[model samples]
Target: VAVTIPVSDDPTLPCLTFRFWVLATIFSILAAAVGAFNFLRYNQIALTTFAFILMSYPCGLLMAKILPSWKIGFYWPSDFLFARGTFIGGSLNPGPFNVKEQTLIIVAASTNLGAAYALDILSIQRLFFGPNQNPNNVGWAASLLLLWTTQCLGYSMAGLSRSWLVYPAAMWWPTNLVTANLLHIFHSDLQQEVVRDRLAVFKKITVLALVYELLPQFFAGYLSRISLVCLALGGASGKLGIAADYSPGRGTGVGIVTLDWAGVSQLGPLYTPLWAQMNVLISLMVSSWIFTPLLYVSDFWNAKSYPITSTGTFDNEFRPYDVSRVIDLQTHDLVVAKYDAYSPLMLNPAWAIVYAAGFAALSATLVHVFLFHGQELAEGFRSSRNPESEDVHVKMMRKYPEVPFTWYLATLVIFAALSIFLVEYWNTEFGMRWWGVLLAIAMAFIFLIPTGIILAISNATIGTNIIVELIYGFIDPGKAIANTVFKTYGFNSLHQAHALASDLKLGVYMKIPPKAMFISQFYGTIIGSIVNYAVMDMLIRNVKQIWYFTHHSPLAIDNHWNAQNPPVFYTASLIWGAIGPQRFFSGQYSVLYYGFLVGAIAPVLTWGLHRRFPGSGWNYVNFPIFFQYWGKAQSNGFANCLVSGFAASLTSQFWLKRHHRTWYDKYNYTVSAGLDSGSMFTAIIIYLV
Candidate 1:
């Protein structure tokens, strides 16, 4: 019943800078080291969870890193609003009820991040562990809870820069790089066959498009500004009996959406909560359960046609699903595994694009880094295998080891120095230049560090927009953190794009036709994004009050999973100026400390809760619900949240707990990726309308 319209008063619009980029690079490297180490120390489950975290907020960061167009892209509807929380564009931007806007951003980022991570974890587990294994077991749940709680605490302690934990830790594209290399080395002969088949399809398409269609059109329209070349000069143009040339350009004119927020002041207040709640539902529940599986399954079927199963049936590692078995490690003998194939349109094109882009960028990044800093990758990989040694990678460094303790101290010292130095060197329109810098530094160190730490533990690092919001606060102290973070992180819209990119890379590795994969994924992303957008808008508009509670009010709070943006702790940040349970760090919210308490005792809680309330119609033991209400109270609203959470959390657990443990015995990752895109798209359309 509490209509809390969450608004972001922070105004620090820190766009891309050399320093920021450099810092991000360092952060990413550190995160990657952490992720690889985790995989070694814990298991693939840990890596998958971490990757999901990374997908949440800085999801845009992934795209920003990979895609060319989204560099200066806008965030959410708030960007349309001006200083006064009024619209700037008459009909373009959604105007603002400041708090409401911020709340939606935070909620969407958090839910999306969690959903993506959940999907990734399940998929990975399904791939390695097997179909019969129950990943939702006490051990897996305990580990997951432990990690999630740890990350939450870490982020809380460091003020919540979630990216430090999720991004590099998840090893997004890096994992693909490793996977691709492995395939190339062991599955070279298999690759040759796939490459041949793929090339054949590509050639066929190219000829059809070029000869029968393009060549004739090009000859016809040789010189106009809007060239008619490549235009279809067929009799199918409208109802006309005569043959005509259609002048539709493949290039889309509108690059990014621009909104006008001024005139929508009245509309803003009315729609804020509505849209916010819708985003939560679409980004979280609908996308997770309904869409993800569909996309994944579709992709699996597409790739199933060209199998790569190993031939050694008697070998101990003989897995029914081990497609990589085609490569005879010793003999290098290759066996081409085949299944019923399908046409290009059957595949999810958008997912393919995401895969391709991610694959290319990751490959490019690795090449560039190796060429420029080969020693670094080698060192990092070695360090991962041996954490105790002061290897060559660490030895060749120009910078000495700044112990974590020392790093914090230095950060503070540097911040103080910069505050003074910048004040003398530069002038600001605001009188609080020195104060602002100090505050910014304070926010970064105080808020970001702990948030990052906990996020690392939880492995949910994608869009932890706490840093972006903090930066926004430092730049513009008057606005709320939510608006700033959303504008900064969500504006990038990177994850979806990155997902598409990664899929394309999968196609390349599988030897799916390059151009076909490109077309499918490109179209898929466009279709997915548009559908997602439409459904998202509908949900937001129709579900008015739901947004208010979900985004800001305590009613939005859930102890089951990590829903409710500007979460209970974030809300406390405004009041106590400290993170986690107490104003300082105490066991006041021990029940909420998922890692130490919830995660550790999850098995017990699962049993106890169910035993005490037999047939109560609530399953607290489930991963989906367990995660959702880990730190919050449990109730009915948690129903839908648990649906997606359970489906995503349990699916892999069901498969992995009883299956093999390596890529040599894995499920199709491409399938999962596709399902997530397509199903989520379809679900969004259904849910929103």
Candidate 2:
């Protein structure tokens, strides 16, 4: 039963506004490329994350006016918006811009962030500044190509046999639904019958939001900081003060009245579905809100001396710890005498517990996959071998000749071979071995299917960095660079694979050409890699004291880009490379290792209960996902987000979705777009001023 939607007798696809789209896309790339380079030098990562779609909103509005008057093409802005069911339209609907190219440009812009991030953590952070005694001496060419190839090799695999994960509607990647609707909101036909005035609603909301934002963002911004506790106890966070450092973000309990939505979302506020948000918030309440406070108050792991919400390593005397000074220059191992003189690598009680829980999470992910997806995996592979006789998405896709699996094989081999070549040939101070590189790739391949399955079901993908770190930790204990590079390959490659797979699904639904999709993903990644490195390099050379101050620095307490995720990568390099996991996980912190067993068994037990009582609701409990969301960040990272994020989730995912499905679907993505666009645009202005 191959049900297909018949198209009208049209020769070729409509080129609504070709010139404007080209110009808009070029401007977007140029803006992101140049802005990411110059702006992120002084500003935080947030400034560079300006949503292209948000930028598109204003541009599309502008084009609607200009394209009609210009008298350029055959269809001079006749039907400004196309009712493709995937995009939204407006008054004039805009001529030059359409949905297909919109996806391409946004996808291209997205490609910038990952490569910069990975390289910054692995090579750039060390080679230029801190930690590594003898930094990697590889030139620009070597670094750029290496990063580009890895992303390409892994991502290309997703294109070859994407049917199983994509075709089945059951594997509804909920995030994409949100994205599709957002695109629909952007490219939708305003004159259509189903529901008109959607664009008007977007405009109304956006204007109101922008006007309201002006108050908190610029004039009398004190409204943004409406916490009573912080106002009351302005200056008393001393050791014995009753304030207990109970400032809004500084102290414990939930920071209420922090009403800045963009500040809260910073990265993922708008897009994260209510379901995933609820799960994460529940875990945060358990971990950070309730448990963390208790542990900190009790002075667990010398919490009294350290900030309650950080992963900063502390000395036994509660002084901040640094690994660079502790490493022996010749041996790359910790000097035992100095280490003995120093305090053991200690963390805030909150993060210490998370490390343990993270281990449990890794095992839990594997176990949950086996329990839930084991049967489906076999069936999916068998069915996908030929796209034989199932879902209409599969049958429809069967029309286009699939990219040969051997191409995927060749891609993986070629790029991976290049990666290994960089390691063996460059042989820089990183000390990455050939075997270690292969093992990382092997690890990525091993987990890709299961993790991909997990990501497809629920848009959340639990990172396996800890597992990869643990593996290489044992292999090259004293080699920080090796361990970091290994983890990047193992974890990030699959991370990229997930991205490509999702894009493929997006292309499928949108009916974009597969070959075109592959070209965009593969080449977009290469461009992104080059631009990311170029941006990172320029910023590093230009900015002074701009690099991330490690946990050891007193200045790291500030809420800046440096205090964010990069430090975690640096810490892993030190912990896994400098100190070695054996000394921590298997020795002094031996309890962390057992987390794997705890994780493995718990899910198995849950599965047994599900089998025992079919209707007992055991199946609904995703304990693995629960554990995966259990980890927290250092202070200023997710601390502020938890409380506000919880409330927002409850409002959106729970109350609104349950009560007002029609309204929620119609307006959710639009509201999100307004917030993201308004805030980002405002933030950029704020930076410029």
Candidate 3:
């Protein structure tokens, strides 16, 4: 905290002024529109909060300079209903733009910067499922309700868990540290030599990255994934058999490297801690290089018949699983007789292992947090009640009125009821019972703290989607839409809770008023959801071939609108929902059930080892991260940038961090932010041109 985050706070700064709301609203709409639009493309890009930070600073400054300092006041008429004598006043410009305003703008804009998770449910239903498959048939009211409720339900969890997740010093969200530092650099006085130097470096790197990105991104596209093994084998068509399964573009990338900054930074090499990065790299290496090949060569689960790595599900005859044949279009439910007569669902080795890893990671997160951070959680709860033990940042934030717990409770209660209403009233479209929504909320509430703790400490998260899918698939068998709806509520609620907690921490660090933070984030969510639904609905209705594999559409490939996420989401529904985990988890894939046992036991063993060898770094083993990344290649193809990612981590987090502390502290995060901004802008410009 001392090295990266500023310890002091200036409480006199103005926040939530007229300028803030204007900028926040403008950026939030742009972010939502761009985010939702890009979400359907093959090369998905987001206008990140970091980019917002960089862009908003200048805009805020420009507003402060140009706008007149005019204060306006409004007084209620004497016969007004509620505020008979109340007066409200504000200014066009709130003096000079400060860090507090900048921080709040970033927070508000960021909430809607990415496509909401609920969009996945809506998209899959429209593109692949019955009734809604016709774009015009999609229900806007149901879609809006689903988007709003799922997006906002998590705020309640975040507010309720603030004591343990946000106020604790030990729960210092590492990612926020970088954000905090960048904010300070941008808004701080530039007269200081160190600040000036850092800004110069940031600018230089931004331009360099923007110019250098064109080669890998467009001109020399092969530089994005250069594989010596694939080159040496002369692109032979299975001539060398299993030995030639290392194509960076097509197969598991064993000896490959990516020159693209966007690809290299996918795993966050410059910001994530070294230990966590190593854990992910180690798991990826073992699973992709050694274990996956051995299973394929041995023809495990008839893996030789399918591609070395694929997200698609197949049948007994090694053909792409035709989901339409096994489903009754009239009811949107699986036809058991047709399914039984046809071949059972089969997954490639890589995809199969991804499910197992997801299972293990979920369980491991629960165990790891309980064993390692149990005492800290208890301490944090106690300290939250006793203000004397509050950290410096929290103490500084005490001047601002905190958001009331009742507000969060009301939010949770109201939206949760709305969610149930949607699923119940729109059962034909949603395909889930009212009780399923409650069950999903219960599961999300139960797992929020443990997963939040994991994210807060390690800067890595384990999603509850897999487990949610499994449980709901079993409970509501053969109903794919129902299973997905349950997964969205159960999984996305927890994910949003963590995101809110992280933003809350940023607020605390920046000394913004808690209530202001709440208002901005809540407003952003509503606006973003509306924009997301509008953009998605527009594309589905207007574009005839927006869905993948329609008319063998070249637009999907050339324009990078291939619809990658929906297809994967559709396949998952087929595997865990239509097929039912009961049938899928038995037979040839019965071994996957052991993932739970392995995940639960691995953390216990690590805890013991840490107790036995206190100084040997056993505590950093982090089984959850290892397991989560073990099968990462299954969904994210090849991961050709692991080598470059590791090299970047070594240089920034290890070498500069140890050898040149001053420079590292001043410019490390700045470099990461600059590179990201440059690459993002370049990608957008390239797409437009």
> All candidates' lDDT scores?
0.28, 0.62, 0.82
Better candidate by lDDT, 2 or 3: 3
Best by TM-score: 3
TM-score of structure candidate 2: 0.82
Better of 2 and 3 by TM-score: 3
> TM-score of the candidate numbered 3?
0.94
Highest lDDT among the candidates is held by which one? 3
Candidate 1 lDDT, 530-587, residue by residue in tens:
2222332343345433344434456544322222322332232221221111311122
Q: Against the hidden reference, what TM-scores do the models get?
A: 0.26, 0.82, 0.94
Instruction: Report residue 238 deviation for candidate 3 (angstroms).
Output: 9.0
The lowest-lDDT stretch of 10 consecutive residues in candidate 2 is: 1-10
For candidate 1, the clash count comes to 132
- Candidate 2 overall Cα lDDT vs. reference? 0.62
Clashes of each: 132, 13, 0
Candidate 2 clashes: the total is 13
Tens digits of per-residue lDDT, candidate 3, 97-172, equal 9999999899888898778998988888777766533334547888899999999999999999998888877678
Cα lDDT of model 2 by residue, 176-195, tens digit: 65455556556656676322
